[model samples]
Target: MPLYENRINALNTIEIDQNLLKEVQVGNQSVAKTLVDKIIENKATKIAIEGWYGVDFKKIFNLIKEEAEKHNLTVTGKSSAGLYKSSEEIAQYSAKYLTDDPSFGWVNSDGHLRDLLNPKALQELRDLKSESDLLVVYGPGVAVEELSDLYDLVIYADYTMQPMLWQMWDGELIPFGSDEPDKNYFWKQYYYNDFYLLYRQKQYAYTKTDFYIDAVVPEELKLMSFKAYEAMIDEMVKYPIKQVKIMQPGPWGAYRYRDLWDIKGLECNAWNELAGIELSILIDIGLEKPINILTQNIMQRPLELVGEYVHKTFPELFPLQVWLDDGYFPEPVPWERSSMPIHNHPSTQYVQRHFNEPLGRYETYYIVESYKGSSTWMGYKEDADLEEWERLCRDSDNLKVIPNWEDFIKRWDTNVGDLFLIPPGTTHGHGGNQMILEMDTGPSIAGTEYSFFTYDFARNTWDDNTKTMTAKQMKMHLEHSFDNQKWIREGRVRSHHRPRPITQAGDGKYRYDQYETIDEMPFHIERIFMEEEAPGDTQGKFMQIVTLTEGERVTIVSKRDPRLRTTIDRLQACVIPASFGEHTYYNESGRHAMVVILRLKKG
Candidate 1:
């Protein structure tokens, strides 16, 4: 039998003020009508529709042009693409940041939106602004600093990440300066160069845009004034906010998600619960359905959302990631095919030197639910053969022979509420038959794909293209893995990584205990066992991630403001901002509750 039914609730929505909701206009026609009215009222001739990379600027421009033509006015416009650098120039300039490997690249720091624009074409466009009733500029980077004075009214077009990825997968997106989509190099270039360039552009546009448009759905565009957009973000940070969860299947995916979530057609491997760079948040604005906004946008109020130290440290970057690893299966499965690939992450100095990222990937796995044979793999065995293990891994990759991983790696029997700290250089993977809450440091704004895969136990994965299972031989970074490997043996793993919990505070009703972590780890883990209620505080320093591992339901409320609160069900998590200083947890169900809390260490 499965551990739970299909009770997974992935919606993360917050209700906002209705007055602001009324200001939100739906559909391109309505938004275009509003913009046309604004142009007439202000007697504006120059208009700019600046957009993020994936926005449909052509659709918006056409709608506005139609609306302007209705007023018996002449409208002339051009896409920002005309001002972009040549394709060869862009590829040459981006070569240093991108890597030979298709999956990885360094975050760009050397180029800006203006750097990508041809000065000659820019001057031509500026000079071409005519005496028509409306002179319009549309596309990404149209509102950049160089073109700031080119428009009298600026509207910023935005979309969420999921739809953008879908467009990328469908080959609908063409990279800047390139006429056609290069499937081979699109992901790396977009993540490393395009994302950062547009991110910086959006920051500047935020200050100057008179209106913001949610173009996630092209046919049904949502438009609001800059004031309303700012008000929405301000209201979001006032309380706990949850990011919309995204689930993915893997070669070693388990069947638990099939039972837990209302999803079909794929086995679930992991849930990206709080992956700030990858996921978005749903905002309830008294609409038929909640509007989706990128999770990183909430960081506009960095100090309020993440606190003083984190705001100073990360600076517009959401520094944490949370994932739920599904490992439950009703029937027995082969250990090789059921386990995760043996992998290790880079250290801070190592990542800085190699990838030009800000922080290293530090991770922890809190076992939320476990069955009879649940296990976790961490480090190496005390008596393992290192040289033979390396040879076998290479043979598995090159010769199609599965290596005896148990001979080299150590395994521990995991139980619910057990916390395992995995610092960089410490090899780790999740064994089957359990559910794990993986909390880790988000290393970059581009997205965290830093796990250096070593061995995959020679499994077969489903291929969407072929409609059949195919041999899954994942690329391995053995050289980097060996360089970062600490070779933590069984003794050190038991003594250092899995320290026994010490009671920090307790009363007759509730008990709070702190789990001792390794000195190198940057975050702290604690659990609260409550019979009815428990008190907590963020102290105005660090943000807190609260997950109900063993509770039916619990309500987290702010003591200062009783109106500010959210209820989380079993296995559901919510982020408590650092500004939510003092809060209390009330167990909604008349049963014992266990909540795991994670926070970054104070410097």
Candidate 2:
């Protein structure tokens, strides 16, 4: 039986007040009827329904058109694509940022929705208002500044990430101004250009829109007033927040997740606890079902959520990521099948120069559970042959030879609660037979691809579609790996990366020990053990991401306001916002609770 429940009611939820919840309308018919009533009551002439990239604007437009026809009103609708520039022009402009790299692209920083618009088309769209009694401007970018005055009432339709990704995969997601999806640069353009522009548009829409609609399920649309949306967000920031966990199966996956989580069918490898952008937040507002929104929505109040210093340091981004690397198996398996590919993340300077990213990837692994023969591989042995290792990696990439990775890599025995700091350029792999809690500095949108894979021991990967092992060689970026690789020997790896923890502060009921971290590490890890409870304070400086490593359950509550509290389960993680000051951890399980706290080091 799985020890952890896949779904926890308290996690990733914001309870909306009853008064505000009463205004939320469920189902597409209810939402469409309400909008039609509003138009009739206010005698609104022009209405704009702006949506996220993957929204079904045709369905929404038809619904409203049907409602208007019943009232004997002449309704005419035009997609916002009419106001967009030609597909060729948009592609040419996006080419600068989406340089020929298939796996990487530069962040389109200065690009806006207006850049993709045509002045002639904008004027044509403006002229449509006089032709019909109800002029409906629909689709993405309809709420942009250029068209802000064109609409009497603006509705912002939002979609969740999972459905959006599925739509893109199904080849149904056509970019604005394009009749068909870009077969070659479909994903690249969406991430770098389309998603970025739409996200910025949504941020602006949050302020000016009259209503917000959850269009994740096209048939079951949820409509709420803009005031209700703002009120829900205001209440959300006052407490700790967690994200829905995302489980991914990989070739090097182990058996621990099969037993720990209630996941079926797929072998779980990585459990994303609080990964930015990749996860969704579930908001509860006394509805039949919770509303799912992008995890990035929490950044709406950056200062209150992450603090001023962090907000300024990593503008418009979450600065940390938390995940579980499951490597536990009941019995020992072959090293090639269980071990991760020998890879290294890029340095801050290297990424900034090459990828135009904000920060580098710095990772740490804290052993949550370890079985017999559990180990972690990091750095190179003192007697390692650099030239031979490089040659083997290159040959392996071509599927010509298999490298004996053990000869060059250094392995360290992992124990529970042991912290291993993995800075950039350090070649590392999570050895099987242990469950590792991986906490790392969050990567920017484009920075997520900075993990330059060096070698994979010439192993085949598991093909989910075929349900069999396939002979697929992993892609190796040897040149980048060689340039960024640090020549840390076994002695240096043990002395510098692994350090003893010293007692920072303690009392009769609790104890706090601070782990020694190197200067290269921007974050600090501390262990808090509580017999009954332990008090903590963020000092309004930085956000604290915590994992309840031990104990059945623990409640994190604000000392000033007890009502503001969230309960964390064993092996589950949550973020204590910077604004959530003077909090305490109460051990609800009556056991000695152990909590691991990760935060940016004070400047």
Candidate 3:
């Protein structure tokens, strides 16, 4: 029931407190009378309400008509070729007629799409631009801010498109090509239509558009170098192959049509390395011309440089591979070779590019101690970052999250002893052993261009003894680019001495806790534990929060406080928030009671 609906007693729905709206105006500038306020409005001569998330057709026409009428004119609703269903797609003869006019088109990823918008249909509307008419696009997540300057208007609401569309138009019908600035409004919209094959088949089956770099993910939960892969292959048996259309949507299927349900055999000899498993599948619609990204946290790609990259990788794939470049990706001011970028510019916003709904990513990674002989001052970062993974996984069903094979992999890697990438949302150094040799890049962990790395480390060279960035070296380099004040104040290097206590729930079995994180970032740190027989206090316990799967190890086998402790080894993480104490874990058996400690704060 709507909160407003429960006026009889306590309300649990949205009751528009007329006064509250005034307060909201001051409190949250981003929100207005409606949800989305259009940040940019360019008057296009011609266009179509082809589609976008949460939009309505009648509402679209009404808005356009109202805007047009304001100019003593009314919108002449012309049906573009694919305005409803492309005439070409429906009636073979009609297909040529509708498609002949390039102004209108559809978003199915089959091969027929010409440009982001069909060109022919647009030409017809060009005349209106000169007359000062406005073309209002009806779509969801179609934020003009996130894409390569596409629509003049956007309706950006997560769920309902109708109310938002009306509010932006203000009970008026706006026509295409209206250059009226004060009257126009909307939030930057975002659309994942380009990334899904499932959306392609039912509607615009033959229209294939070019895939862009906006879809590439910059960070992995944990890093897997050639060595880690080799170790994993040796330990795990070759899993059998099976072809099954998944019960749910998967990463591979989200991008292309034929890829919709083609998950086939998992080959041990995956890709170029025997270290990973390569599954067999085919693209459902467009066979994307593959490209790599030196992308940053924001998915920003310099427009010119993006072209250069595509030219390099897909020489044969050529200009046809396609891409959109947003100038948002941030790079080190003075490029640093000695260390990784303090704050990576790779774009999580690029997740918007995946026509694949529910697929967004936030990534952060760091170091842990190495487990070498006789406490030889060596140990690898633990692979089971239980606190971090749990949180990210908990919201798995919400965002178009990729499948959690990584979660299981992290656990398995833990038991067998291998380091995995830290889950995308954690700034972790397993519990309290702060070692040298840690590098990470993630989404907006902070609101500004600040990335915090500890410059204090014992070692400054790689295993081969080549000079590498010590905690000090990395810090010195970052000082040139970052505003260190915040780095010092908000995102200072983390350690046990400054351990931020994050509370979580425990049923004497599952334990976890909130880790610290910064604003503009969406991840929290957490700890987890399980133990069958507690280690003696004298020897000290082994607490690690690595990302590998602890195969066959139940919550009972691994135990710890699931809170931030510099002492224990083997911690697991889920993306739980701190302050609320939402991250906790535990294990049974007093003799082997396990404690898993972790930390979390919004990042």
Candidate 4:
């Protein structure tokens, strides 16, 4: 039996027919009005409509009310505004619990949206049933347990923000630049807390909803049955999927990605964060432009996409992230030019306890392009004074801490095809003049970009929003970094990170090389070097994410179904679903190709 034999046997790999999708209605105001009328005919005296956070349900509610009044039923509109606590109350609690202080422990605000919903408002909702023949209540948290009995019928109205290639989605980007003080404040408190709140509300809406509307495309109501959404996810899981990539500009960002991708009007660094998790599916409806749909909206059946074990282990989310880091600096330049801030990620225990995440971050860097003077920083000196290191990091913001970084921090010269393992709490960063593929492991729910910086020496670096690490944040870093820190000699660092041969294939022409493996890591990294062309198989074990690291291009051919093929260009990545039992990597260009593969650990 193969590694994932049991999983494959347990999984129902049924591909939902596309024709069945037509059963779900897709239209505009007319369709919504029809749904409202259906509820009214069912003898519903009062109805409550809920939506995901940040969604305005007023239009949907008004349309329903207009139709209700036309039917000679007395209609009443009751906004959920009265349920919200005063802004002062929210602000005061936000200040107390949402700061960077590690001692200020809590992932969300106290007495938040659901907790603060006014009891008096619930009473009013109950009273409306006696006074009016029809009542419409709409807003976030309307689906909470407290409001469950107040409605005769409950409906969910949700919208997905469409994504554009090389652009930030509507809610992810921090507008008004990162240098703004308010932006910093928002990220520390409001930004993260709001996401948690939204995530909770969305989870509640899943079980409490009677009907759902995919209001993603404004002026259109893509009405889908709850089962139709499940069918959609089942169909989506049968094929290879790609998420739209976004380009980001930062203080340390370079222009290589901009020029490579032919992106106009931007000459800065480019990186794609949370590519697999924060997703959008590209659907081709035979139109000039394909629609971009958020994957979260269609994730009604999680098991279909992630398999049985993964669904059980990480039921709420996808656990991996692939990020591309493109940096540029001329050859023979100072190392400081390309270096990122000296920082470390939190440990699994620390993040899980504090942020309610399943795991902390562990990343590995695969070098794609390495210049003459390319290098990276990792680990700490063997004899480094612990107190001195802490003092320097704590006082770095005031410029009172300056030390020969290369002496205390282990710096390694780099070349193409090199991989560096950065375990959590490891102080590490790569230099400029290199393009690196960052393969990281994250928990299902929390997107992983947690870094605590000790120092950054580049000029004007602090101007970037992310680089502005406040004193309070630095203190938090100090407390968290102590236990996770590893001080080892230069030789041990190399021994730990150096890639070793794993296996040979096809008369030893094809080879597999493993980067490194930490205990209990959820994923592993390897490089596949194909001499001319070679067959690759997943063996029903784990899903593999492959990136063409070298050569012009490579095609992935389905071993069982030859017609199923995907071509990946140089530096492009694709996912091989776990259900794709066997495949082959062919160098259609008739040249040797090197592909980097990241896969989940085999049980």
Candidate 1 lDDT for residue 6? 26
lDDT of 3: 0.23
lDDT by residue (1-603, candidate 1, tens digit) is 011112145444566667877778887788999989889998988889987767888889889999999999899887887879987898888887787755577778657888889999888877884878898888887788887887889999988777777667767775676535556547677778888898888888888999999888888888888888898888778788766666666667777766555654444454435434667777766666566688778888888878888777766667777778888878888777668888988877877887788888999998888987898899899889887877787666633645467888898998987888899988889987888999888888766568987787766665544534474566678777777788777788888887667889999799998888888988988889999999998898778888888769999889998877888887777778889889999999999998888889972
> Cα miss at 499, model 2 (Å)?
2.2
Q: For candidate 3, lDDT tens digit of each residue in 1-603?
A: 000000011111112224322222111111211122221133333333333222234444454465456455434444322222242333342232223312221223232222233344444334334333444443321222223244433222111222223344453322222222224322211111221221222123112111111111111111112132222222111111011011111111111212211223311100010000011111111112211111111111112211233224322111100000011112222111212212212223332232111112333332222221101011112453544533443343222232442232211111111222332222322211111112122211111112233221222222112222222222222221122112121122222112343545545543444444545433333334444322211012111222212222222121233322211112222111111111222222243333322211211
Model 4: lowest-lDDT 10 consecutive positions: 1-10
Q: What is the TM-score of each candidate against the true structure?
A: 0.94, 0.94, 0.24, 0.79
Query: Cα deviation of 236 in candidate 4 (Å)?
Result: 1.6
For 215-253, candidate 2 gives per-residue lDDT tens digits of 888888888988888888788888887766666666776
Where does model 3 exceed 4 Å of error?
A: 1-203, 206-343, 346-362, 366-491, 494-503, 507-510, 532-603
Worst ten-residue run, lDDT, model 3? Answer: 1-10
Give Cα-based local distance difference scores for all models: 0.79, 0.79, 0.23, 0.60
Pull out the clashing pairs in model 4: 253-269, 254-269, 338-432
The parts of candidate 1 lying over 4 Å away from their true place are 1-19, 178-182, 464-468
Between candidates 3 and 4, the TM-score winner: 4
How does residue 496 of candidate 1 score in lDDT? 84
